[model samples]
Target: MPGIGPLLGAEFLAATSGDMSLFGSADRLATYAGPAPTPHDSGRVSGNLHRPTRYHRGLQRVFYMSAMSSIHFCPESRRFYQRKRSEGKRHTQAVLALARRRVNVLWALLRDGRRFEPAQPATGTA
Candidate 1:
């Protein structure tokens, strides 16, 4: 809710219909939303992951757009994205990774009926 504004919030609500039960887990929701790449297994050749053909395009767009916006509006999200970028991930790849991560956070928030809060930075003692 903090990073997501009215339009994106409405899109998310419409896409999910405000129903978290439909997805038993955040991974399921991410898969449905088209962010989690599906694995393809065929005999000896395995470990091939690709975007699912059968997925909610609108839902995917909602997550991508919201993740992009969150980079500026949410410090934690921005840091995550930057970390991904620093790891040699391209722009789109980083955004997609962030979007996938958001799916987990959003799922937990919806399940527990809690609001979004920026994660506090960890403090290290010398």
Candidate 2:
């Protein structure tokens, strides 16, 4: 029953490029918008990690759609998609990885005024 105001509610739709970029990248924006997935990985498998919690449906839709959209619109994200696919990860599986990775990038972008950059391979840190 709360957040009924247009500003506080779901009435806001992006109207321009500037408005969209204001969130830095989709992941941070999705996180702020809410509904980002709760990653549940212990070793290899992901996506179907845990039972769904009491999260806002609207927020989840926002993040999911935004992640999918970025796959088409965001160049860096698209490259990640291809890379994940090349690594033998399935489509949805790769997307979930991207979403989880986006959460961290988004958090950082929101904290600092930088855009999301894909991580480079580590040098013998393993």
Candidate 3:
């Protein structure tokens, strides 16, 4: 929500058909959006993951663009992106990870009908 603008928001709504019920869960939505990789494992070739072959590119673009914009506008997003980079992820991979996380948040918000609220930093008292 922090990174989503008018156009991206409209695109997301159109992609999702304005109904969370169709997805049933955030994982499902992510899969549809192409952020959730599919396994290409066979016997000894385990841990092999690849992009899904059939996903809504428009939806993926919506999430990817929002994730990229969030890195500059949202502190939490920046930190997450930095952490992913530290963990050996490339820029695109980090952004995709953030996008997947955002999908979960968006799904929860839609399911609960709540607004996005940034977490408050904790203060230490002497």
Candidate 4:
């Protein structure tokens, strides 16, 4: 667990390591990552968006586990968590959003068959 952090984890990579062809594209990646929420109709009531995986538990666990660490070890993740809290999102909601964001980035990488782009330093008036 040394130097290992969330928002990216061994689990995520292992879950995604097989069959790039199975993903097909980035949008499909979104769906696979549990970011693509489902239509929740509550018996003549409105709907909501959330995860529901009867199948991809390992994959979901990857994101969730990563999320758990990201809040503690990642600056950007911490910032996002703070921002979401300020915006009135509950702690879980904030974390879920962060996980989905990471999923999108991973999706882009998968789409291009490329490794992750390193975190670029912020450029400002120096």
Instruction: List model 3 lDDT by residue over 15-94, tens digit each.
Output: 99998899889889988998566689998999898975799999999999999999999999999999999999999889
TM-score to native of every candidate shown: 0.82, 0.49, 0.88, 0.67
TM-score, model 1 to reference? 0.82
| Candidate 3, position 1, lDDT | 78
Please report, in order, the local distance difference test score of every candidate based on alpha carbons: 0.86, 0.57, 0.91, 0.68
Highest-lDDT candidate:
3
Order of quality (lDDT): 3, 1, 4, 2
Q: What TM-score number comes out for model 3?
A: 0.88
- Give the candidate number with the greatest TM-score: 3
Tell me which residue pairs clash in candidate 1. none
| Residue-level error in angstroms, candidate 1, position 62 | 1.0
Q: Give the total clashing residue pairs for model 4.
A: 0
Regions more than 4 Å wrong, model 2 = 1-50, 113-126
lDDT of 2 by residue, 1-126 (tens): 111234322433432122555666655455454443567776777665454555444544544555676788777778888999999999987876666665556456546778556567569965
lDDT tens digits, residues 1-126, model 1? Answer: 555788888988898898888889998898888856768889998998887688999989988998999898888888899999999999999999988888888888888989876667789977
